[model samples]
Target chain A: MPTREINGQSIEFDNEGFMTDRTAWNRDIAAVLAKEEGIETLTDRHFDVIDFMRKEVEEKGTAPSIRRLNKLNVVPTKELYQLFPGGPAKKAAKIAGLKKPEGCI
Target chain B: MKKLLILGAGTAGTIMVNKLAPVLDQSEWQITIVDHHETHYYQPGFLFIPFGIYTKKDVIKPKRDFFPTGVEVIFSGIDIIEPEKNQVKLTDGKVLSYDYLVIATGSQIKPEETEGLVGDGWRKNIFDFYTIDGACALAHFLKYWEGGRMVLNVVEMPIKCPVAPLEFEYLAEWWLTEQGLRDKVEIEFVTPLPGAFTKPKASQLFGDFLDKKNIKLTPEFSTGRVDAANNKIISWDEQDIAYDLLVTVPTNMGDDAIARSGLGDELNFIPTDKETLQSKAHENIFVIGDATDLPSSKAGSVAHFQADILYENLLSAMEGRPLRAQFDGHANCYIESGFGKGILIDFNYDTEPLPGKFPLPGIGPFSLLEETKMNHYGKMMFRWMYWNLLLKGAELPIESQMMMAGKRV
Candidate 1:
């Protein structure tokens, strides 16, 4: 783990920059992190997904996989990719202040 | 007499029965195994079926032949497990109680989980090598078919023998080249993983192999449904991949019995202690092989290694002793790379597959992570060893825990 000054406060994260302390996250931090991850504008839909992912971690102790989200009909995977380009799972997990998803790889 | 009940007569359960049969006091303990099927298929050989190397005869064997004598066998499907009562009810309405239970009910391909996977094109253009019928049907189709755009899509991850899809592409490319159809056919591997595999090093190695062989790689394509009418697979992200022949590994799930008993996750895999092999929900219940939701691969080699730890822990539990043995998720696999050469990989939870010799530290007949003809021969001879020695609990020279002494860092 490594510590970096994020949102004017030092926070712990893995080498990949996913936050280790999920509780330290807020919308201000997410907006800055999202922009760094190439998410130009944070819309209400993006907040919906980010909030849902945080809720999933609060309940399941892990971020929801793209398949899981699609199966639960939380959000269509197409919209997810459109909302967060590149890899949505990795991006959303970072913004939601959740640990990287394990179990698969 | 206290009863020891086992579910599934597959490799994991059979090996446990053999390992314990000679050790348990026959006068004090009565051993019984239950399974729904009479025939046990050598699942690894299923991959060779599509390439015309192996047939149905090579893989099919009577499950009764594998179990040792003095063990009571029940041929019936499991309905549910009443874990609290320490009893399992068979589909035939018979109740069998046990002092201890071992669940080895492995996973299977659930093609129906994906939309249109089992539709009009199934067994004709859409085939999966995970099942006997699918392999044989694909074999028949490949024998006379001309080359066309071929796409192999893996619906999700954590499927049994994670390397099978890679090996399939290797063999298919070689077979196509040998048949002078390499130029006519276009091949693509579509996977949800970021790369060729879960592990970083092996993924790089395998991804390079695919590139050198000219097979296209499509990564991060989360499959949503199959358009059988148009012979295209649609991703949940709205990506469409067209293929003349679609070979897919659909969503794999644990036995439905796990679901009926409410002892499993969403995929019906029992939540297990990764090291102790004990069910998280019960003390007396042990889980082995693909039935467990462990992060380790679902392969015969994984089950074989788990058996070593499980056997020790199981005996300890029987004697009211604390479980001491810990499984490090050791998995050894031989990858057939076609053209009579193969590669081997030995890894555990913390280690990725590295390049070096195997079994023997200084000298090994089988080289790891590098393709060699000797490795291919090792794979060919594994069948005989599997049937005669492995199933009978013979102690192989290879350690249950992976050894890194010979591997290069």
Candidate 2:
């Protein structure tokens, strides 16, 4: 399995750069992943989404989508794009340390 | 011996080799086609998969089964195309050079291009009918899904089979009613296009049918993201179209290899002469089907129509004769309106879909832009026509150019 070094710790990833293990994720790791995803800074809004996805993954065994995020009323769909420039779900899933969701391609 | 290389063994590529096999001097010219997939899918049948109208076996067949005996078929992914060098590199690290190349690799649905579309909700509440996996998943999802708001959304345009969403909507309505769930499910058609279709006259006609079916038309809604948690599609303008089950037609773009080769437009479609179907970038390279940035519907019928003209033009180019045949962007579509009824539309780059009889002008057979049981039969019968005639490059009764004889122009 391919892996990337974040904060001097080796983190495992798949060929597409998605995290292999969900438990290995942390706020510091998300900051590094966010930068890799082209985000210069991790704002509170970004954390809000990350936190929601983490909580959902814990409860439902998957990350929360924009549709699901919309239900929570934390952010709008337009803002999700702003948060993740391209492929928010894949990026969010990566940053959240979840396996890349199926049927994304 | 000179080699003619073709990319993609789908509808256009298969037809190209089948048509050119006998036309070209076999001793002098060798034809080869490359595609990563082993199986050739009858894509039109994908529309019926969710409804159990057609099974996987009904649509898929080995690519080798359709290739003419003399033509070579390569099952490998293309790594890069060096058009300037007249060569292509495969993922296996093999390089093949060709005197002439035809790019028939078509468009693909990219759900990830849209934010939140491919999230946890994908293949769960949100499904696409464009792919075998997506269609099969949707089929399973629809089986036990108690009805609610069902939205069939086309995220962006220039998609293959523009009317497929409408067809799906019609079928969904028919299926729901048959299952006694019609009253429980509210179906809506969401699109980025301002009308029901690109053509004005046809949009008007189809708009009436959608209205009659009581399917809400949310046109001109540029989709921003899919809020799967809330089961809604959000527009750029913050307009929310909620759905319990969303069947989305995500953004359709040309093959990524086109972009990797640096031979594609903004959307990865190869820039080509609309009339000649020849690539504007390279004189030796020709493009056909959805891969070319031609102003024609990216349907199997359009590919079949273009194949006829492309065949003539390729031969002329090789012979050093001035290319005489011109493609008129001719396209024919059979719109399945469900409940054993369908509609047909025939048009070209210049003509809008009109009401009339097809094939023989004034002779009764298939009606254009009119819903009828005969049109439904025509639609169902096309699966046989595709496998036996269209892919084999056997010429049909229809002309390569658009005929205005029977049309109410």
Candidate 3:
């Protein structure tokens, strides 16, 4: 288990690597992702995507793959890349505090 | 007989008056609207003002003109809303009683909310296009101005027409090119949003448009303070963005009367039921447009959609019937990408914007998530619709509810 401080909030990753607290996860990670994406704040749409990512991981045991994410909605790859520059898996894993799945790297 | 008193005759109030006036018989109900300002400026038209696409005359009109003749228009500021007594006290000490009140007082731009935004360079170099005065002043400044570093900045989010700053930058590029000063001006769009817009798909499309126009993009720049003396915007991280001319959309707050009425949140926006638009504080009052703390775009299209539902529900409330209408946060907006091209996006509470044909599926004259000349014209044509159709509360061909028909899902 490890923890990181992002955007003045503390986020903890479990040994199994899911966010210890999903609610706190959003506030903690939205700021970091927003900064990384070069946005001053997160919009409702941003929260929609972030919440979607969190739920997908909680249900599926892993962060949703890029293909799955693209097919689920119309979030353009370019904008998604800008937000999750390390790619969806890495970024989602980072935000969700989940362990990086086997194939993402 | 119940009385309905609406505060502020802005876009939201105007629509409410139009929607309720025709349906409710005057003998059975009394509707009164109070507003301090005499004029109603076509707010969306402000976007085109600085670019010379629209003139001051094109946007300005007497507020009394749009209101239906039967409805009482009181040109006075509200001092307080004594909800416990179900009475509104005006600045002139006129006490008006209401059985049910609708607060449609829209947001206001407070540039001073951000430190130094209204400092030395305010109108001289820093400008705001949110207000008629600001837009007119900016238009005058841009007329003889030789081009240099022009920065269009959004101080915070939840602004009226979130796409406006981007629209300004897009039009500025086109205007500069047309004026043969494109090379001289370095146009930059600085926003708090991650990309050109709040939505992901539209942001990608607009981000490319920014690239094509050669406009610099600065995202996530949370402004801590405006250093007017140095002509720079200092972000919380201490990132300094230098600008020769600063077009800033200051922090937009709900009408001051909301604070006086004790009917607002920290931002002076009334906390409302997301689906019903009913004021959370009082059962007899409802809120709409920019007045509500709904997680929806504060655009005219949203108001139009909400009006349909509010019209139904308000009648239900009057008749002691169950509220049947539910608003799904439907909002559609046209993003002017400049070069006579625009993009349209439609979405609701449950859906994010998807790429597909709009209004008519598969044979769209207007495309979604894609730019086209037709959408640009559609955006322009909205002005006529606003005055003739929307404000009058006339039924538009488009459905009030967000349709999944033309969209992919």
Candidate 4:
């Protein structure tokens, strides 16, 4: 297992990239993303998409497609890009601590 | 030349312009849109701005920027609509006649309707998240303020997004906890509805979440007045709930022009054939989005769905044919439950939100009526889709008509 500290919180990632502790992943990764975006705080509404992405990864064993993610989420695609400049699969998997699904790049 | 005149360039009207302008033949039909404001806002994003998740720049853009060049964008307030005359009068003393009319004039927030609400505390101790100014002002206020008893109050129902207030409370809990003030901030949710949500099954789940968050619920509260000086809200039954700060969803009404045109109900919302999207008063006139007195939610998703039906029906009406398309009152909302979890709900006029997977029944990448991290990400990513595709009237792979797919009966 590899570990990274974000915002003073220790986050442990397994060999496959899934976070050992999902709760810590959200808190630490969300903190990093929020800071990167220059957002002062991460609201529940902000987490609405982050959590949705994690669940998609957990169920499909891969990051969900952006189109599929947006269909279920009802958010606009451009905003999704802003939240995940690396695109949905990359950004969502990174935040969820899951490996980037094959063929996403 | 046939003229397609649209009233109010709000969410629905802007979408209608984007949807029809490119498709309609410019040689045969000219499209003209009327709106008073120069800017178009992502109204849903307004919910997040108050909580500091979105800034002013995130939610607004120039109206003309989104409209196609061929579509004539008229920035003027509407004075009246004479259905018999087939014309719309502007406050600028101009009259525009139309071969066909589309009323996308959206709703407004009337905080003044409630006694003492717009009194001394408005934008001070009391705030609204429905408007950009209100959201920004509330953001500033929430910054200096430490932990205290906070109340997220809804004056009435059928406000834009029903889940927004609950999202605020949930996000507030997360924010306060981060600030090390969660235990000190006694958050409460006050609504006219009996449950945490409009649907029962989802309500039960959300109600339990409220309990878990230690956020008190005051349901079925018909707010009578706001005692700003005293920091209290009084229900019609004289139940008083004191608070240090009041975040309110004001009484939502249809555009004032609807009332002025004698085309609206007491709330200024136009009565329309729920299925056909045709104005009940006139067959030639159509209404959609928050302007209508429909039982459905006043959400962007509803407007997106209605645009599909209305687009078909308009062409039918233009050809002197019967409208074959029907709206199912379908609406879906993502409820953010903080801590990187969210819930998705899909329902129509008759159905309540039920638990299940969405779009793909057995193979759901997303769950309904259950909180999951995937649902949360889905909710956040939507803003991008709104800007690029949905507002552009670009065809999404998802069907406009509500499907039984991915949902439990």
The top-ranked prediction according to lDDT is 1
In the range B18-37, model 3's lDDT, one tens digit per residue, is 98998899898989999999
TM-score of 2: 0.80
Interface RMSD of 1: 2.5
lDDT of 1 by residue, B1-409 (tens): 9999999989899899999899999999999999999998899999999999999999988998998889999999999999989999999999999999999999999999888999999988999999999999999999998989999999987799999999999999999999899999999999989999888988998999999999999989878899999999998767899999999999999999999999987788898999999999999999999999898999999999999999999999999999999999899999998899998999998999999998797698899999999999999999998998998889998999999899999
- Across B1-409, the per-residue lDDT of candidate 2 in tens digits comes to 9999999989999999999988788899999899999999999999999998888899998888888888888889999999989999998788989999999999999999888999989998999999999999899988898899999999866788999999999999999999899999998999877689988888998999999999999887778888888888987767798888999999888999998999986578898888989898898999999999777899999999999999999999999988788999899999999899999999988888999999789874999989999999999999999999999999788898999988887
What lDDT, from 0 to 1, does candidate 4 have?
A: 0.81
In model 4, where do residues sit more than 4 Å from their true spots?
A1-105
- Across residues B1-409, which tens digit of lDDT does each residue of candidate 4 receive? 8999999887788788888887789999999999999988988788778668889999888877788889888899999999999999999999999988999988889999888999999998899988889999999998888878899899866687888888888888888887788888899999877788777787898899999999999887767689998999987556789999899999888888888888986678887998999998898899989899787888888998999999999999999999999999888888888988898888887777888987678767779889999999988888888888888888876677888877777
Superposed model 1: Cα runs more than 4 Å off: A40-61, A64-85, A103-105
Clash count of each predicted structure? 0, 7, 6, 27
- Model 2 error, position B304 (Å): 0.3
Residue B377, candidate 2: alpha-carbon lDDT: 95
TM-score result, candidate 3: 0.82
Model 3: DockQ score: 0.04
- Cα TM-score per model: 0.96, 0.80, 0.82, 0.79
The 10-residue segment of model 2 chain A with minimum total lDDT is A96-105
The recovered share of true contacts, given per candidate in order, is 0.43, 0.11, 0.00, 0.00
Residue A41, model 1: Cα distance from true site in angstroms: 5.0
